[model samples]
Target: METAQRQQQATPGAFTAFARFVLCGGGVGLASSFAVAALASWIPWALANAVITVASTLLATELHARFTFGAGGRATWRQHAQSAGSAAIAYAVTCMAMFVLQQLVAAPGAVLEQVVYLSASALTGVARFAVLRLVVFARTRSQATAHAPRPVPATVARAPRPVPAPVARATAPATPAALCPAA
Candidate 1:
């Protein structure tokens, strides 16, 4: 019964993490859309999208690490690589969505472009979460076993810190400067 209880307790909850993830993803999508739109006047939409996609993916990964996964310290480059993989897939999907929207919706406005990117992000969110939770941040079986809480003795005394000794200071003798003759 206690083992079963421990098993139940060890399982990570979803609702809070999912909510944060969605919010972070939405913010990334909005920022990416604005970036793309801002650059569109100076550059082609494809180039703009590529640049913003890379930037947003990095931003989103960091945000998700802190807000969504509660694994800020634990998140590593490998986990980031995993997140990047998801971002790559998401970027491809967003580009396709944009292409389709351009064909179907004439003269897409700022609002329309944002909406399209957000829709794509919403579609990709599930896959991103799955990879982050199951692959990137997942604990090994040994780690899980090791992490199980053990009973500690209530009366254990804490260790005391050692005191430091004062040291004698040594001073260097000053050297006199030679006077220069008038030039």
Candidate 2:
């Protein structure tokens, strides 16, 4: 069963996984970019980005586990933690890109900010996809064996052996000839 599942997972090539990753992670990221911009109006841009990053990472991880990487189930807590580590790196890249953009233009337009943020996200997202496929959600040998159903041993049915009948004996001592027929 585990082999079947592994084959099913392996059947999706890297390109297929990447396409699904883009569809799931990219969708969350695009929405997060707009969310960060909206939240920035009320809060500090860095804080807004951080908030959006955390929320988007959680959502994207679940989507990747279910659809992108064919993890076969919901994201595990360990997978979530590993994913968050990669997301933090992505968050840093985006923040740095925005900071650089701000340094270059005194008042950059929303469109320009989105372009920079999204470009940074795209670069990091590619790396994130690799990490997720290779490390975070990859099923280890031990894990696969642990979850696989154990094979039941086959049992053979046998007929009962016949028992010999017992003969009645006298209370007197037995002769040698009776004890030994060839005496």
Candidate 3:
């Protein structure tokens, strides 16, 4: 009982949540990477990347809300907004890295560009997980414990009450004689 209560009071552990985030994020990343690469093949790099980034961010936010964080009920506009913000940060990192790499390598091929983007995205995953866990899905201690129910005892043992000692009665000779006469 004590251990269970302490566990409830403690903040949620990161290992399980991180694992879920990785699984969900990996799927989203795979889909988005393909989209980015395909879109870049046809459209201008900047426009294709931006459009795909927004779409993928929305999709990933919903996925993470449902599975990664276990906050399906709490998913709201605010969460979407945070997801967008985090995605923007990640996108900026990716774009900047791509630009620098292209300048340094001189007309890098499509495969190389894709690799750079994926690498940047991988680095950004750490930040994204942190933001989602600490900011977006943050729960107060009270809020965390609010939904939990207290355990009811199956049986209760009550202490026995002590018995009082008996007292001797005082003699009453006159009263006894009168009572005897009446009888």
Candidate 4:
């Protein structure tokens, strides 16, 4: 609790996390590129790219949530969902950026692809971490902290009243038809 308060007090600009993400993203990108290049002959570049992305993504997410962002194991399934959703949005932006930087701007072909990818990775990492840390995970904690269902006042709770056992009503016996004509 005290540590969190201190952190909030000492909060650096938001850009710091992004800068860290960019640097960390460099590391992740190197690993991912190797993973892709190694598997290139066997798999399509895009498919291998996706595989590497998912793996590096999980690694970066864990690092950012725990060490970078001072989050405490906050990247759970819901956190990943929000982060991944945000990353999807970021990917669109990344694609657009890559298109502009690579095709439109006539950036170098060979290494530029990786550089552009790293740029996009940095963007995606920063955006997704913020969403995961503050929006999704923080909201979960905030939900627990705020608006918690208050215990009902003991006075307001009515003691359970014993329900009476259902009585089985006696049914009247039906008289048989005077005589069975068929018999």
Candidate 5:
């Protein structure tokens, strides 16, 4: 049964997992966009992007780490790093998508164009979030086992003097071989 369960997990459920993760990233992205716009109102786009990226990164990393994956056993500094890296990749992907959208929209430096492009990029990168969650964010099978609470050490489990076996003690006197010598 354990072997079967392990084998079952080896197969990836890409679509379902991606759908869930994408939704999670989408929600985060919406929030981040608002934050960027508010900040960008005062700052230049590039600078605003950097600040917003870093700040939003701080916010998104934790939430995405928790929300994107069902099995969240390993929420550590390393996991946060991985989340940030994946998010940066998603950020880059969104940037590229926005650039393409901007050209297609033909609205040069229009605030509406900026908003539209950013929104669309974020919308498309939903797939990226799912991909990251399944491939990069999900906990390893080994990690799951490793995190399980371990049994106490042998020294703790055992007293210095062990209790005698009651069954063996009861049977010993009744056995003929125990009391009589062999001829």
Candidate 6:
């Protein structure tokens, strides 16, 4: 019964976390797309994308740790490295999408480019959310157990050994009635 109640409570928390993930991570991704587009005018498009990807990944990891995953504090170096691994995958996905778009249309308009880039980002964002939740920000089993009360096994939880009744004074005879009181 208690386990069911806890699972029910967790369902809403997971949903809330996903919603925040979209808001925070998606917002950073959206801004990065525009930033990439602008920077591409000054540098090669691939170079611009690489620069923006690194910056946005750092920002998004911090936001996800602080808010989306309820990680309770700033992201650790290990978490950042794990996050960067997933972000690298997302970057590859976006780059491939853009490369494909370029191959398909010689002169793709800015709107078409944005649409393709955003679509690719949204897809990778879902995957990144899973990776972040399950890997980068997940609480270790030891950490979880440290905070939670451990349940005793049924055998270990058996009623405490029945305490022996007090013996009568040596001078007085001990009666059965005195030694074992009626329930």
lDDT of residue 71 for candidate 4: 52
lDDT of 6 by residue, 1-183 (tens): 554344333332668889999999989989999999999999998899999999999999998877787665688999899999998998899899999999999999999999999999999999988888877877632244355556666775568888999977766547878777889
Q: Candidate 3 lDDT, tens digit per residue, 64-108?
A: 776677663445898899889999999899889988997899778
Q: Of the candidates numbered 3 and 5, which has the greater lDDT value?
A: 3
lDDT string for model 2 (1-183, tens) is: 867557464435689989999999999999999999999999999999999999999999999887887766788999999999999999999999999999999999999999999999999999999999889977732365465667788878778787877877776647867666783
Q: Model 1 scores what on Cα lDDT?
A: 0.74
lDDT of 4 by residue, 71-161 (tens): 5454677666666667567656655765577556653565776677667766676667577556855653454434435556676777899
Q: Which candidate, 1 or 5, would have the higher lDDT against the true structure?
A: 1
Q: Once superposed on the true structure, which residue ranges of model 4 sit more than 4 Å away at CA?
A: 1-15, 90-109, 123-126, 140-183
Question: What would the TM-score be for candidate 5 when compared with the true structure?
Answer: 0.55
RMSD of each predicted structure: 20.5, 6.3, 7.6, 13.6, 12.1, 10.3
For 78-143, candidate 5 gives per-residue lDDT tens digits of 766766676667667656766676677775564664576466656656655655565555555345
Sorted on lDDT, best first, the list reads: 2, 6, 3, 1, 4, 5
In model 1, which runs have C-alpha deviations exceeding 4 angstroms? 1-12, 140-145, 149-183
Question: Compared with the true structure, what per-residue lDDT tens digits does model 1 show for residues 1-183?
Answer: 465445435444678767877788877777777888899879988788889888888888787766576653435677678888988898798889999999998898878888887788788878888787777656422344465666676996878877777877866446433244346
Clashing pairs in 4: none
Compared to the true structure, candidate 4 yields what TM-score? 0.54
Model 5 spans with C-alpha error above 4 angstroms: 1-16, 96-120, 145-183
Q: Scored by CA lDDT, what does every candidate get?
A: 0.74, 0.87, 0.79, 0.62, 0.60, 0.83
Every model's TM-score: 0.66, 0.74, 0.71, 0.54, 0.55, 0.75
> Quick one: best TM-score, which candidate?
6
Lowest summed lDDT over 10 consecutive residues: which window, candidate 5?
Answer: 3-12
Clashing pairs in 3: none
